[model samples]
Target: MDDLVTLWPSAREASEAEDVPRRVMITGSEGYIGSVLVAKLLDGGFDVVGLDTGYYRAGWLYNDGKDRPRLLARDVRSLCAEDFEGIDAVVHLAELSNDPLGAHDVRNTYEINHRASVAIACNAKLSGVRRFVYTSSCSVYGAAGDDMVNEESTPRPQTAYARCKTLVERDLMRLADVDFSPTFLRNATAFGVSPRMRFDIVLNNLAGLAWTTRRIAMTSDGRPWRPIVHVEDICDAIQATLNAPRGAVAGEIFNVGTDSNNYRVSEIADAVAQVFPESEITFGDTAGDNRSYRVSFEKIRRHLPGFRCAWDVHRGARQLRALFEHVGLTEEMFLAPPYTRLRELRRLVESRQIDSDFRWRCHDFS
Candidate 1:
């Protein structure tokens, strides 16, 4: 299983048949999705460097140092050319992440999500790396109404975090003057557990609510269709980007997910209840952020048709339920004031746990 993660195409298959061995950098390496990605990259044989501040807590990256080429503990603001000195591609995943969390500190979200991202792009260019991937979200599509969104869809980011992602994407595109090989993945709402356990995502939250209260809360009518992907498939998408031809991905945006992964919130609640059997599912009158619509993964899959999606939502929720049980999560897990309220990036600043001006240095782009 590990051997397959780093598998590269043959030299003759490289279109140009060049001999540049791929070396990739994954930021946010310790987060929920990133940690799983790190494992895949290492097992696939890519010289992978994981750059993270370890903000997701200690257990988040327990697998680090075992398989990755390197892991750097540093803030994004401190990223410089030397940081990416020998890297080939950059997967930028560092962010304040999502609406509830961003609402905690809009300023912190903007600074880290946009400003620091632009800095990373510049460094990637300076360090001579070609491919650059920014992990954007389908939430940038805002309230989809009933529209089926493709890459051509104009982003209507509805939250502080979504808007911040849109802004960074713009900055990265602007630097196309440097001929940066930019690939934007407006990923679907991601779920499933990783080394970093986030109870915040929909499926995880629903499973948690089901476990404790026997009822999963629906913020709204729960009728909006949402695209979701398991963490493993997201890693596959990143690996696909890493190996795709330079011309195939340069200056392009692809919605990364599976068509079949789309599900209504009410549907997700129902699935969770069915999987657990003992849990009861309930719904609300409406959704909180007012965002809904299914996203198409055709662009990415058609381009890289060989890519595979292994985990579906039903199986994914069951996997998460077992994980929650294994972790011994308590009712107070989400009941605490702010960590419970949501991860407050701004309060992180006030608490001085975050060092904003800490010289964002480069880790792996040359």
Candidate 2:
């Protein structure tokens, strides 16, 4: 780790002329948030390069007609320093994205999310890629009730996915010297329409249920505190991190999303019910999943002046409702394997498209 940290220029030396990054590389550019972030960076006048393993390529919800960046169809696990050559910054988002997906295979989760991620960061630093914005999750504060947790609070990761996040953050921060600045954005649960629309997340799933069956039948008591933000707002936070001075963001952990956006699972359901008025809501008495947390996003607002959530739960739900009507979303579309990460991966494994280690078979690669 020390040997890798010494490869980059001193932070003090680099900070003298830290202009906004002009060339950026976004890993997982074909995934849910990556799809939206690619357009955002392109529109903002940055030269963007995208890299993804194309696991979820089968899912394209709608055509937004926006111009896309140059994409490298490659796995993050196989990336080396040469791939980051000439790249000024990296927004790393590729991994088993959520708690359930992480639980699908715990060993593979650590391999991809923790080990591969740290390897990429080391490669980035070695290649003199100064700015690294890592997308972490607020899920690290697992099971922390009522009281809001901040970046300084101790993380109690409940699942393999969340544990990988904390582990990656820990290892990456050790590499943060005067030369390489790595900022961790602990994003709230993400929702909103994308070309790679996901029905696995809370808001989108509830809206899909409402559109398809006109009912939200929750198996749990719906009492867990969950904070959600629009997918676009997450992109906004990334932009802010990349544009900020090295000193302001280096080795920093900021919880992305507004404080007001935090909501109990029942409250989120209520908001969804309001958007799709025809949907009937029902809940079971038991708390089925123990992963729950209310996060404080005050540090991001205080530090990154440009960062703020534009959409709340109600507005995001309304956006999903509009999208459902526009696309004429059907039950089959909502339940498609590609829209849900774990389902698509399972399908790939079962069909021999990808190996048990999640690598694509050579013949299956286009």
Candidate 3:
């Protein structure tokens, strides 16, 4: 925290030094979204400190068997209360990630996703951090009932991942009283080649299946409406928030994706098929199962004022095909042991493959 205060002019310039430019502390800094977000923040001239306890190491795309970024490997939970110094704001991107991983240990999910989050927020606020940007998920607004779901729509979270994000969103509203301008960024399901590549997302997964298996499977009937955005776009939205005029963003909840980006899983698959000509596609039987709704992105655009997204699903798919070829991932190459098998996080823990303090938070929450 001394580093943050040092930027201020001498005591003679009290008012000038009072409002410091944002020095962002990005937890989960090396993960799928966090790593991309880090680069964006750095490029945008924000002094950034990254924290990542590499529990899931495969998702890191920036690691080129060479020098990596200046990310401290520390568990979010293990962060000393004193560790909160010099931070101007926080972009909390660390968590158990998705449903399957959260399900591996519900307790681990709640503790890390919920408890640890509150801890970070509390510490950061106590340490005089001003803005808190949390990367939430639109999945909390589950199984939408109409043509489109907007911010006013009720969030019906069905899984632990969605539920945890919703819980954080709720709590963030209260952080306003602590002088922390908390903003909830409910992002759409991200898919694309980012500094940290995630083949787990829908479009990326389909591209993977198409590339290796020559087939893509759809169980959500290919009819469910899903709001999709590229990872870069999501990071761009976060960058827009740093020291933004408080009214447009402070203590606000905005759905972060473009209206033009929602696509039917089937439509997306077909699009990917066209992009990857060798692929065959098949739709599964649950067409009427009802977890579908287009999302209205006008609220964020008109209100946030400066918000914009680059790379819709179509552009993201092409990038994935290129990444696949570059990585030399072939049909004979099954996903890395930890790629598809999320439970391997446990074995990763035992092997000391990552910082163990994080694994301590990985048990079943329920």
Candidate 4:
């Protein structure tokens, strides 16, 4: 922790010595969304710094040949105010991502997802960072049925992960002030190809199943509504939030996705089938996972006028199919441990690479 904090003191001095470009720090910079967001911010002419614990670093699906930012290979829980001193904004995405991973150990989930995230926001505020973009989830509206839930809707989180997102949003709102403006972007379910690919998400998982085995075997009846947005679109929302005026975004919670992007589980499967026509599809009678919600993204469209979703589910499906065909994806590759968050974390804990608390036992885990 000291070593990581010490490295940023020189960065602070350099920023104080002269005017610099807008410096934005992203936690979980090496993960699925962070990788894409880092590239987007760089292309937009922002000085980017990334911090990731490198849990999913082993999973590189494909290289996009984009320049990456200077990454700090450190845990979010170990960060302090000094680490964020020179940063103008902090995009917090470093957490145990998704539901099953959170269910694997509920205690650890709250520790990192809720408590540690709040701590990081507090640190960022203390260090004089002006803008904070928190990558929240639409899953906070869990089990809303057919009724479209918006930012004002009461959150009925059904999992540790979703619950923690709510907790962080609540806690961080208290840290918001005239100087520290925190924006909460409750992003829709993310799908689309990335260098650090994840097959655990609904659309991505279905696409992977369709590609590898030519079969999408569903465990549920596929009746629940899910609002999903492309990975790139999620990045676009983050960029928009960063560039938007502080008064417009501060203490605001915007669901990130378009109104038309919400689809029933069965529809998502059908879209994937269209991309891979040879794939067989089946669904069970039971609702396997209870978490489901249809989110209204009108607030973001109204608040951030420049933000718009560029990729829909169909386009995102085609993108995945193209990448899969280009890479010649096989069943083994699709079922790889790192592509799924729960599987990879379990492997680490069982192999003693990371301890019970999810800390790396050694620096040479790779």
Candidate 5:
């Protein structure tokens, strides 16, 4: 918060246009998903303002350009009403992204993901912000078995990450009314390439391992079903939620991604194998792994006509393959701490770059 003093103005002083707002404030704007979404919003004719703590700033695979939106280096927990003064919409993407990262500290998961998110929404609503697009995860569907779960499905959250998503969704729905329309987008497992590329995801990890080690090995039996959407499609969905009319999106929870994009773990491994023909794959035991869900994405499809998923697993795998080849990716880089969120956060804390509360020790850390 102190670092933001010199870099960013107070939200009241920051607004260039007060009457009309083509302005959007995106939290975690430098993240794997946020980095891509910021560019999309900019291209879509919005005056974008980014807020991020730069937790994953070290996770660079390559530079797509040094260019970034006007960003505030601040944590979401510290954000006040002054931060949302002229913001038209707030796309909340900051959180302990996945299950393992959420598990690292359950209290932090509830604190940052659930409690902090609700605080931001309340502040946004209090500040007269029109919309709040929350990036919830499909992992909340936990173990829905072979049945395709929809927005109304009973969520059996298996991890702290999933539970926090459910909590935020429930609380945000309660906040929605005539003034503030909060849209909860439960995104499927995200894939595809970005500047801050992550190898912890199923598709990206499998493809990167194949490219670097020429081998794909699964710890689980590869039997659990997962719905996946490309990173760009997710950005499109966020943009759609941002631009939609108030009445249409008010208190709505839409599952992002496509119904056709669902695949088992083994199928993703097979797709990776196809992309890298020389790679070998090994399937492990599936007895104990209970996480499996096939999500129904019809709600988002029907609601947001402008949104469409362009890339499938095969296309995304090929994209990752091209990226790995271009960067000369190696086994060491594949297993590096930066590319994985939990590993990188652990490294940052252990090295004293950030404290246990996730606040940076110095501006140099950003």
Candidate 6:
């Protein structure tokens, strides 16, 4: 009874300590999801410190007036334990983000996504950072047929990008302890507005094509299933995980999306076409892009009641159309490197802005 009374204030103090403004460090905070998430965290009163190699800073679609967080323009591979000092949590979003970029150089994908990510998490754990929120992807469930897969389902990651996600998730789990809580948010395909927007994604690409070219089309048959969530809602999920009780999120894996948001590529094209009446729809098998998965988001809903997907495909399409109309999106801009991750990375490589390892190359002006 005396011991219980003595421990009560310490426990209460710890809980109250967490209630104060948290200092969160987000890697890849200049990219698509990272940009929006930084703003959302700041608006939610988190003290945000952003770190990025600035691979896509020139890829701005528009000015949203969301100021960049206190930033460190450094590569994730170079992150040391000292970087985690004074940080309450670390949101790991840095990577070779998609299939095309992964396909471009499989070795680099494994290096940055798999190896570097695990290294960062290990450092965070060593530095005593309590919460590590990994922005994993449903792409890890590559080619999961008609059945809806959940956190327990066997991951069948097909591409190098997806394979790295599974590897990182597995590696991070090994570091989880009472003092270090790691949460893997296997996010569905992300869409909707962001200051650093990506049109390489299905819905965003189709919307861009429809608005700029007046045509909605696909290089594949458009049958692949993809569950999507809005960028803001993804931010919501991250924030929830950051503030969630340690017991609730410790080493937990949650599919970050709504079940109903899953759609076939053709369905997404149709939604975009509906938004732009003048746009014609086209489909063909230019390539065998067989990746498909229907994800179950029930775990997050049940575990983290505060996390909910607030955007659907139709709503996201409408939002994109409005943004495109407001900006007077041109075909040239739509097809530019700024809107596509793979293209932008390619451009950076060609110009020697970044080297083969995707590290920024220092200019030799002297």
* TM-score per candidate, chains pooled: 0.86, 0.94, 0.86, 0.93, 0.92, 0.94
Candidate 3 vs 4: which has more TM-score: 4
Q: What does the lDDT come to for candidate 2?
A: 0.89
For every model shown, the clashing-pair count is: 22, 3, 9, 0, 0, 0
- Tell me the tens digit of each residue's lDDT in model 1 across 112-221: 88899989989988988777889999988888876688889888887899999888888888877535678898888878877666767888788888887778887778
TM-score of 2: 0.94
Off by over 4 Å in 6: 1-15, 18-21, 364-366
Kindly report which residue stretches of model 4 are placed more than 4 angstroms away from their true locations once superposed. 1-21, 285-288, 363-366
Writing each residue's lDDT as its tens digit, candidate 2 over 1-366 gives 234323433223433455557789999999999999999988777789999999999999899998999999998999999999999899999999999988889999999999999999999999999889999999999989888899999999999999999999999999999889999999999999999989999888888898899988665688888999999999999987876777879999999999999998889889999988888998867544787799999899878766678999888888888888899999999999999899999999999999999999977346
Query: What lDDT does each candidate get?
Result: 0.75, 0.89, 0.75, 0.88, 0.87, 0.87
For candidate 5, the per-residue lDDT at 349 reads 93
Put down candidate 6 lDDT per residue, 134-241, tens digits, no spaces: 999999999898998999999998899999999899999999988888999999998998878899998999999898888898877888888989999998889878
- Please write out the lDDT profile of model 4 over residues 1-366, one tens digit for every residue: 223322322223344433222799999999999999999988887889999999988899998999999999999999999999889999999999998888889999999999999999999888989889999999999889888899999999999999999999999999988888888999999999899999999999999999998888776789889889999999988876766556778899999999999999899999999999999999877544887788899888877767789988899999999999899899999999999999999999999999999999977557
Q: What is the C-alpha RMSD of each candidate to the true structure, in Å?
A: 5.5, 5.6, 6.4, 6.7, 7.1, 4.5
Total residue pair clashes for candidate 2: 3
Off by over 4 Å in 2: 1-17, 285-288, 364-366
Clashing pairs in 5: none
In what order do the candidates fall by lDDT, top score first?
2, 4, 5, 6, 1, 3
Question: What is the C-alpha lDDT profile of model 5 across 286-341, one tens digit per residue?
Answer: 76557899999988877776668998999999999889889999999988998999
Of candidate 4, the 10-residue stretch with the lowest lDDT total is: 1-10
Give the Å shift of residue 63 in candidate 5. 1.9
